[model samples]
Target chain A: MTDPRLTPLAASLPDTVPFVGPETQQRRMGREFTARLGANESVFGPSPRAIEAMQAAARDVWMYGDPEAHELRHAVAAHHGIAPEHIRVGEGIDGLLGLLVRLTVAQGDWVVTSEGGYPTFDYHVTGFGGRIEQVPYESDRVDTKGLIERAGWTGAKLVYIANPDNPMGGLQGARAIHEMIEALPQGALLVLDEAYAEFAPEAERPEIDPTDERVIRLRSFSKAHGLAGARVGYAIGPAPLIAAFDRVRNHFGLGRISQAGAHAALADRDHLAHVVSQVAAARARIAAIAHDNGLAPLPSSTNFVAIDCGGDGAFARRVMTGLGARGVFVRMPGVAPLDRCIRVTAGREADLDTFAAALPEALEEARAAP
Target chain B: MTDPRLTPLAASLPDTVPFVGPETQQRRMGREFTARLGANESVFGPSPRAIEAMQAAARDVWMYGDPEAHELRHAVAAHHGIAPEHIRVGEGIDGLLGLLVRLTVAQGDWVVTSEGGYPTFDYHVTGFGGRIEQVPYESDRVDTKGLIERAGWTGAKLVYIANPDNPMGGLQGARAIHEMIEALPQGALLVLDEAYAEFAPEAERPEIDPTDERVIRLRSFSKAHGLAGARVGYAIGPAPLIAAFDRVRNHFGLGRISQAGAHAALADRDHLAHVVSQVAAARARIAAIAHDNGLAPLPSSTNFVAIDCGGDGAFARRVMTGLGARGVFVRMPGVAPLDRCIRVTAGREADLDTFAAALPEALEEARAAP
Candidate 1:
């Protein structure tokens, strides 16, 4: 007989990766992608100051990172104008989301999110045995009222909404988000993922209180700070919930160099401002490229543009595959309606130039496909 | 009314940090520890090649790490003479332990471990709501037979054992470990944590097949490889179980820089060999220092020595506090009997010299304490 082995929940789970990285695809293709923009990672790169801090910390790999993430948390708290107790730094928002799921979702519990939203959050919900109730987006934006309605009906414990949502690069304004937060059912909590907050206009960003028990906001260095490879993110929430993270988190999960890099990245406001403007410029260029190719570009407040491929999901998939074949890496949404578009990250001039060159050929190949 | 909340299990858990890192202590003391020997981290540091690789990767932080960790996993698999499918790498052994506990230990499930073994493993067990049945250490080593007996009686889903264990530095031979594996109950899997495997004599390390379903062996670059700050560790086990990690692991948990550093560190075998020998020499020096101070140094196969203060747990704690006050960071076991000793990590000559100089004064103060 086989071993008594995994718990039933673990046994039921399929060995699935929510997303395949561009590197894996590159390996299988036996070639490097000339334009790398698949995963919504920052292409402007971390500040020179941040890179230098990481390099300086590289020789100190013997000691484990501070478990409390003291200095980094303090820096983040100061940046957000919150107490250090309000912040909990983690490996990344990906890691933090898993912990949040563990803390709230139990077996057979209900969690709510927009359809075709972040698959990583869904993976965590399922991994924790939580049932995910999907609400279809309203005009390409996460349907806030629909999400609240579903949560109330299903008694969902957690409701996830990514401001400047992935795949579509759509955003909801502060007033809409504030209403959503206030509308949450008594036992429900709003997980506001602000991973792209730095790229959004100030007026569009929410102004929720850090101590609001009804909400917890997650931010990442992976987006604007250009430190995705550094694996640093932080959650700002009520002290009680943030305190709970200590009971379950891999306390030493953040690397010492990552902590150092993050601290420096936070301090370099000029670099962040520069990256934001560059992302805006690149976004405009991407939209222009889409318009030139006879595709429609959705309005974006993020570092990426979602271009409607003017056909079915299959057409979009074909375009993405065509891009892959042409040495340009890009991604698209998985579900219907949203799948009519391909998402491209803001990249450097050279990287965008490569994408610009490859786009016409890729579109031609897609159009020529049976 | 309060927000819809964490699950009852999550709410019921206490906010606890298993180990308070020396960095936190240093911050509290408003000064850095002179020797920095508390965490059992290697003072010899990661290989020069690893530092170079990490520094090189700093500029490339925009990319998220490969979700599969292909190159690093392949390198580790090759080094161990196993197929890549047999290995799963994560943030560290701590992160992997959290994943393993999540996989096997559902609420109210039974798990077994030595009373004073790795606290991080115990933290994971409780975090997952597993009922931990601790078998006391026998004569300063993990009670292997006791653990097996407890597992059988409780129908434990998992049993944990650390070879060349932390805090105590006591080890069991390869034959004994193999026997323990064979004796595991039908419903139980042994989590053989070999975090210190590189430091032990080759004959003392077990020779279990990589395909063994009954056991999962964990190894860490954080230990002898001097990459603790990098947060890289891997598990070697049956392909089925190794595959299950995909369901719950933060797919992009490991940093791109960390993966690069780990690959370079693994390739530098000469650096690893040199660190191992240096750890051994440091262990000998620490033991000699303990003897000179009229304390008993437990024989060690790991990178740290456990010094018996020739008194009770309280006495040992005072000595540890005295050392801490003197800016010589060190740690002691949390439980009784075993707590009679203070754990000191092996450090470079200058670091140990700092410890050697601080020991006598600290001992005198501890001895004079009421």
Candidate 2:
């Protein structure tokens, strides 16, 4: 019997996830990793208050979460000193990206992004049948001017750039981003993914007007607030554009426990500051470990450091495989130049110690094999 | 500045939620309801073991939920005596329905369903630019033969029916549903939404093959499992259809806490049995209360009772408004025949007592009004 026919778009799309989570890797390996330093998850953990709120919310899981997410929206808006109409809460930045693409992209529409940028964004665009016009990174950072030019040139519907970019952990200044926003084509949107925003310097965060129609900024609790597993993310955009999300989003997508945790996490300013400082310290230690092993660590603004493994992509892949074999879960970029380095999350001392102990042996093995 | 252009399909869609949640009304009313029996949520609550599991999971919210939902999938599969490959977990049945529509329904693709069926399903179809061909219910029950005929006639890509259906709380025998499945047109998929399946008697449930390519069954922890707020739902289908969900779904949409709770809740068969029994008792009590108030309660196999107020749609709407005014939250169906009744959820003694006391006053007020 013939299988049910998929939509032409769905039929053409490969079954893929943006990232193969570290847990899947561990399960395949038949053991848990000694150091969980991949995926850029904050190992320091969520605020104690957020944990309490989640535990409390657990008892009330029988009730459906407020479809409108009213209280959480209000809290998030207040946190940014913007009206709630300017924000929309979703499962995570990943989910929001999918919605944004759905709202704007039609079949064969053009979308622009830096090559080796956020793969989830690319996944969303491709899933919606949007043609991606990729601009290569320059000097190991997302080339903002090149992206804007490409968007304008192709009349792209959306341009996605993760500020304090992932995989490489690089930051572009606010002024450069503002200029890119100004250069956006009339009908195009600049999807400013600020998943790592909290980790960057304040000045590096663009001071875009919340009501700016050309740009929508995404924020997440996954990094600094340490709730990656909760999957809470919100987008700040123009009121009309924000309202458009209601047309396509799953109204009850946010879990009740997640909403409660994010609400409490937003209220705990001290916890965020503490995590930021802890991440800073961890970055220094990770960089020190890289230097101790004679590897070059790239300067990073976010919670992870990408260490150059002193070889090609194949060599770096071997190093990553060795790390995985040694129970240290780390990742590398999928593309060239970026793939010469291994990315490690900023983790606690114990996690870093495991990584430090594993790295020398793993590198020696890779060198010997090559 | 010009707004970012929405795709033509997204532009034409209305900003609407399938159900205006009780919380949204409460925020507007500026007071909490005395009883929330509108949404069919189990006020009996989830298993204590599930709650404990969620509480523990909250501590590890820093990490991302397993994108594959491995343990949860395995547990769900084991519960149903199916291979794990046949199970695909999602944010909720609502979310899963959205993905199903995305997978099958392209622009202008035809989808068939009951006229007053699950509006969320319609919402997803329209959001994906699919045309809906709605068949009216037969005597307050989803018209199985009529839906299949329509699906066959229109060459619909998808057909939706919620067994132990919502809004009306009606049931159809397994033999009838099996006949409908046989009648489904080739290339058309039968979306069997068993969101309220656990509450239905075994005789009322259809015994379909788990690997049936012609049908996909949706199950939820929202009803009998009492974890609606956690947003866990799964689909049982042929392995190929189940695998397609990975292409479009938010990999981490289900939160870590939710996965843990659902896993624990699945194992707690005792909690589920207790809830089912409690729901049965509450349904009886609600029916008696309806009879005492000189209203007619329809025969129900699910968790809610639809009480006919011996009036037209307008009159029943007035009664619903009166209930709301009296701080008792309840909902009535949106269309005719069905709209002549107000749907009330099965609640605890105290909650039903509140409903019992408020019903007479609400009826009196509605009768007294113009």
Candidate 3:
């Protein structure tokens, strides 16, 4: 019998995940990680109110979620002081990025992003057969001028950048982002992934016009709000661009419980503030731990810090592997010089204690390895 | 500044939802749906065990859901006596269909389906720029032979059918489905959407080889499992086809609570049997109500009954609108002949009581309308 034929594009695409979850590693190792700091998920729990809301909503799981996600969208809009039309809630920033790529990047279309940026975005672009033009980071930060230049050169349809950037924990000021937006090539849309926006300094959080037609800003409840498992994220952009998502997105993608939790989480300003403060404290602790271990920790505007391992990518990989073998979960950037640093999420006291204990032994093993 | 440019295909598509959610209607009416029977959700509700599992998972929403969904996939595999490699879990059958279309149907590729089959499947195909070759339903059921013929004629890449079909609650026997699978055009993949599989007679549930390369059976927790809001669905197919999903899918699409709920729901066979019984009783009650109102109710193998209004599409539409006005939320097929019937989901006794009370008045108003 003839097998079902996959589209040539689908067939050509490699079967790989953007990032392997810690659970998979746990299963492989037959043990759980002592410090669950990998994947940059907030180890801090979601707001108590969000937890209550999700638990309550669980019993009402018979009905499909509101396809429009009306309440959450409105609440997010009110919080941002933007019209509801400016918002489009989706499964997560990942899901939304996939839809965004599908909407803009046709086969062989050019797209631009920083080298070793969010792998998921690159995965989506590649899955859709879009050619990615990667610009190297300048001093561990997203090279905004380089991205603009690449987009202009390639006539790229989409340009992606994460403020308080992933892997490197580098921050580009709001002024830099606004300048980048203004400098975007005509017809090129900037996909500003602000997944860590809530963790950034308020002043550094770009205050782009909600109605900006050239850029779409994505925010997630995953990092600071601590609801990554709920898969709630939203994009803010021009009404037309936001509405266009409705054409191709899974209308009922968000779960009812997720919507309720995110809505409640948004309303609980106190919990958010508390988590931010806790993260700040944990970040300081992590930096101190790195210093004590004779490593340099990068300044982070997000929940995770990138600690330079004072070695090359291979040495950092060995250290990461050693940490994993020693029951600590952490990750490093996929490409160098970013990969010269190992990324560690700011965890609670006990979690960080485990990380701190594991780091020295892992570093010793890495140095002794061939 | 120039607006973001949508791909030519995306720009060509019209902004439309496959189904207008009851929540949307509720908002416009300034009232909640008294009985949300429109979406074919199991109002009988999910298993208590599932609810408990979800509630417990709610607290752990800080971490992203297991990207591989290993545990849930294994449990589902064991339930069906199939290998875990055969299953690919996704957000919902709607989300899965979109991915399937993307994997197989490139631009302008032909896809065959019954004219008034699942509109969401058609929406996915259209979103991916596939040209649909819709065969008319044979009687009230999907025309399997016609679908095969159409696929052969058009060299369609995909052929879609919902077993124990939606919108018009019809079932094709297992033998027929097996034959249809055998007769599928060489390169065409049969998308057998068995969303209502548990509602169908056991003998009617096709026992296709799990390794069948020509067909992929899509199942859902949304219907009989009563977890529509959880958005968990799986596709069982050839291992290669299943693995290919990894190339383009949102790896962490399923929320943690949703996975827990669905896994628990699957383990509680007693709860599934109980829901099937309840749905059967509700279907009988719904059919009786249609008969009492002098309408013909089609034999239902699914959680809904499509009651023929003994009129054309326009008249049936009026009946549906009248029912809506009376706070009885229901839907109808979107094409001719099939559109002559209104579809009502099986709801709880109390909910069906409201439907029973409002049917006659709705019929009267529909008849009175110009």
Candidate 4:
């Protein structure tokens, strides 16, 4: 019998994964890393209360999670000072992005983003057969102006921007973002991903109208809340667009434990304040380590610091490899220019101590490489 | 500014949720379900070892789960006597079904299923713009022959069948399933969802070639393993097709706790066997209850028994509503002939005591209704 026929779009796509986890790297290397600082995960972990809630939720694993994710949605809505109708929760921002792409992007539709912005967003756009128009980052930040101009030219349906951007950890001020939204072409929607909003200063996060049809804000419990492994994220937008997600989403996608954990995490404001302070200290430590190693540390409004290796992409790659060999796990930007820097997440004192101890040797090894 | 423009297909689709979860109903009613037998979940709950594993994993929630889901995938592969490459773990069977539909069904593509088969599968198919061709059930079981015939005539790309069927609890034995697979039209793929496989006799499950390109077998941790709230499901198929999922699936979709729990659950064979025996006893008790109430319980190979109320679709719906009002949550088939029955899940002794106490009154109320 003939093999099953894939859709033309599916057939044309190549098999790939957006981000490889540290676990896979550890398995390949046959040992665990001494410092697990990769992927911008909050090593400080979730609140003790959140852990207790998840543990309690473990006993009720027999029932499917509430399909509507009612309690968690309301909690998130309250936290954002928005009505519950303005919020939609999904497996994560990644899952929600996929659904949004499906809803708005038809084959050959145009979408716009920065050259080395979140690869997962680009992956979703391409998966839905949308053509991407990438504009290079201006300075270390995402070029909002470039993005808006490209969207205008391409007549793109969707435009994506991540505040306090990944890899470089650079922020665009609230006013810059408001201008970007105002400049959006007719029928074009801005996808403002604020995954690290909790880590940024309040003024750096735009205060958008909840009913604004031009933009949708994405947030994650992964970073500041320390619930990355829980797979909880939410979107806030116009009621109609938020409600539209119900039509195409896996209604029962969220796990009961995840919902309980996230809800508890949101309720613990002291823990969030503690995490933000701890992350600030860690980021400072990372920056100091970069300076001591004779490297340049970029300004960061997020949990990670990007350290310029004082060399090109290949030299930086060798430094990253050397760090990995020294049992410190870290990542770098994929595209050039940004690739000159190795992105390091803020970790606990012990974890960063491992990174600090390894930096000099890794830099020496990279400098000595042919 | 104009609102975002949805793709033509998305704009044409209606906003709907596949199933109204019991939690949603409970919230609407402003009370908790007394029996909780509606969704066919294993009230016996997951293995204690699995619960411990999950609770332990919760502490590490700061880290994203292994994108490859290595340990759990390998465990699942070993259980089925197949290579790890043949398995693809997803959020749940529902999530996997959506991905499968995306892979095979393009706009206007044809898919075939029983008229009242799992509605979530149909939701996924239609969400991707595929046209559905439905064949009526034969007796209470999914009509495999009729599905094959329909596929041949419509040149359908995908055909879905659930063994030990939902809503009716009917089964097609191994030989019949093998015949159905053999008769699949060229280029047509069979999506065999065996979510309740652990509850069925071994002889009833088909033994197929792992490399068979014609079919993809789905299994869930939800039903007999009692991890429905954990949202773990897997697909076993040809290596190429299984690997293809990596291209489109959320790479880090599975949660760390879920992976750990499923891995622990798979290792505890005694727990699985105990749950199976418990489900069997509960099903028998439900059948006995139906007989005492002068209703006929269909022969079941699943965790639930479908009892004929000796009435039409509307009457069965009324009976379900009556059960809901009486604090016993149960469901019924959505199509005719089969709709004459209300499906009740196997539950603990106390839970079923509530069901037994409520059934006669519910039936009387349904019969008394206009």
Top of the candidates by DockQ: 2
* Candidate structures ordered by DockQ, highest first: 2, 1, 4, 3
For model 1, residues A1-370, the per-residue Cα lDDT tens digits are 2234778898888889799999999999999998998888998999999999999999898889898888999999999898998899998999999999989998899999999999999999999899999999888888999999999999998999999888788889999999998899988889999999999999888898988898999999999999999989999999888888887899889989999999999999999999999999999999999999999999998899999999999999999999999888999999999999999999999989988888899889989998
Backbone clash count for every predicted candidate, in the order shown: 2, 0, 0, 0
> What is the docking quality class of candidate 3?
medium
| Candidate 1: residue pairs that collide | A187-B4, A188-B4
Worst 10 residues of 4 chain A by lDDT: A1-10
Worst 10 residues of 4 chain B by lDDT: B1-10
Poorest lDDT segment (10 consecutive residues) of candidate 3 chain B: B1-10
Candidate 1, after superposition: displacement of residue B154 in Å?
A: 1.2
Candidate 2: residue A97 Cα off by (Å) = 0.5
In the range A181-271, model 4's lDDT, one tens digit per residue, is 8889998999998899899998667899989999999999899999999999999999888888887999989999999999999999999
Models 1 onward score TM values of: 0.99, 0.99, 0.99, 0.99
**Where is the poorest 10-residue window by lDDT in model 1 chain B?**
B1-10
Which ranges of candidate 2 are over 4 A from the true structure? B1-4
Q: Residues B1-370, candidate 1, lDDT per residue (tens digit)? A: 2224777888877788788888878878999898888898989999999999999999898899888999999999999998998999999999999999988888899999999889999999999899999999889988899999999999999999999787799889998899998899987889999999999999888899988889999999999889999999999999888988987899999999999999999999899999999999999999999999999999999999999999999999999998998889999998989999999999989889988988999899988987
Question: Which residue pairs overlap in candidate 3's backbone?
Answer: none
